[model samples]
Target: MGDDQDIGYAVTAEFYDLLQAETDRRQARRRFAEPAARARQAILDVGAGTGIVTGILLTASAVPVHAVEPSAPMRAALLTRLAALGADQRARVTLHPEPIEETGLVRAVDLAIASNVVATLPPPVRRATWQAVARALTPGGVLLFDPPPETLPGGRETAARLGPVRVGPDLYSAELTLEPERGILRSVFTYRVERDGVLQREEREAFDLWPVEPALLRAELEAAGLHVVQAPHADLVAARRTAS
Candidate 1:
């Protein structure tokens, strides 16, 4: 995660699960179930926010998982989520509080996954992150992820929506701005907490996302000695480490 994304997640962490909802979990599980089921050994989950996909991977298999998350608040939530699982399931996971590029993981994994995470990284960090992921994988290991489309409308101001979600005593809303020239999406999220129908507190956070082009991403993966393939899921890409 970039600094901006970290800030955004920190502010919204309290209500992140509410925003994601059960439907989001179901869809993610459907998308990742096959790959998770195929894992015969260790797996790594990059930017494993709130442990949604991490939980899915655990459910699919008892493989050991290393979950890397950058934001402190998100990691807190992830830990809480993991604690709710069975002891065996919880024991299978190891949490790292570092971004993918900087995570000091010495063990090679059989599979690695990053879901909706690469797009939020700055260019230099994004490339370095991919290289780190490649380094973490064993030869012939697979990497699966979805990068945002390059064709997203560039210069647009999306309408802001207020109170689109109500999570317990809090309400959430977001405003988005897209700058195609910079390949960045800027977002401002608002959180309002109320008690007894009285507003008690309100907070706002900003995030910047840089979505990489598919062609450029493919080139980077190849440069890292991985063979890339477009996965069945829309916008999803799978890359395999080539034998040295």
Candidate 2:
């Protein structure tokens, strides 16, 4: 809906884990593991917010995992989780404090996973980001990503028609009553972020879903000189870069 904004360090820092409450976080990561086992060895998880996929990447295989998350708060949470697992060093993990678009990784990795993060981006930026992914990957390295549905990024028209929906914490659930009669899909993101033992924030960022259709996503990957081995769905895109 707008130019690519950084989303600031604070917001993105804790964004990864928060998204799990709404999106199918586990299945998305599992999708990466099921088809390709060898690709798991050296992974670059783009948009590795708070390490949700980071956690999966570690447990799913005996591979080295590098997570590039632009949000400082999210990195803090990821570090905390990493420390909890006693993986401060042996985990073969590197957490980059930058967005995937800004990262300049040279060696081709076995896999690159960009979850729901890419779908919301405007077309040009998305193209540029995917191109970066392709360049950083080896030929045949899988590129997986998933965009959100029409329920995000301020798709108010659909929300309004969908009517009321409740979401959030066990006790404090956020409620939304859409009036799609006026073309709006109302929703609420109820999540909290804690940084370095400090509870920093609580907020809801609404979405009017700007879904990137699966067909279009596949076409985009192919256009970028990559093979679309699998289409996007439930926040997953399985693809590979073409051989030069």
Candidate 3:
């Protein structure tokens, strides 16, 4: 039942997929597809923004997918995407308009994924989410997620430009500021829409994220009854439920 007030995804939802097109494409191929294909039973897609990963999971396998998204706009986009899929794929998905901490999964899942979602949560919320995920997973079930790098600068500083990404007529520019003491990383994104080489509209959105160290995250997961394992990918962390 988490609201979108703090996350700011509602403001960015319209342009999110377009803004992160390249990164999403690469991750769909390199990260999501394989793990989804390996799922034998149910799979839970946490923070299923715009259904990018949810669509990938649907196409990769026939396993029932529970897609949890907290942002209303993002969930709307996800439902639209689901409607466009084949009937069989659509039938295999269940959309949950709630955060992972309140997943309300009917049954335990064999695999759960939360790409780029962990760092966005505050510390207490993050811990509660991990515990909830553990409870939703079957014993030995796998969980995969990517946390931000531990080296992220910690300090109050003016916004620093990250870079610009473009997809056709849409352009997105990113800037970041860090408040290390609070474990919050704030990112500001500016989206510009242009058609026929004329400026149309520009929008700005911001998000706050908390980055935890690998060791700290590992300890947290272990305390939640999960066995943490470093995945082959540097940014990815894979954990398995060790107890029922």
- For each candidate in turn, the TM-score is 0.86, 0.70, 0.86
Question: How does residue 34 of candidate 3 score in lDDT?
Answer: 84
Error of 1 at 152 (Å): 5.6
How many backbone collisions does model 3 have? 0
Model 2 weakest 10-residue run by lDDT? 157-166
Model 1: how far residue 15 lies from native, Å: 1.3
lDDT of 1 by residue, 1-244 (tens): 5553444576778767876646658977887888888888889999898899899989987689999987888888899999899999999998987777777664468889888787777778777877888888888888888875566564666535544476676555444445455546765566666666777777877667676677998898898877896675875789998877
Report the C-alpha lDDT of model 3 over 81-149, residue by residue, as the tens digit.
888999999999988887777766633798899887888777788888888888888888988988755
Off by over 4 Å in 2: 1-5, 8-25, 88-90, 148-170, 175-202, 207-209, 231-235
Sort by lDDT, top down from the best:
3, 1, 2
Top candidate by lDDT: 3
- Cα lDDT for residue 161, model 1? 52
Top-down TM-score ranking: 3, 1, 2
2 versus 3: better lDDT goes to: 3
Minimum summed lDDT over a 10-residue window in model 3 is located at 174-183
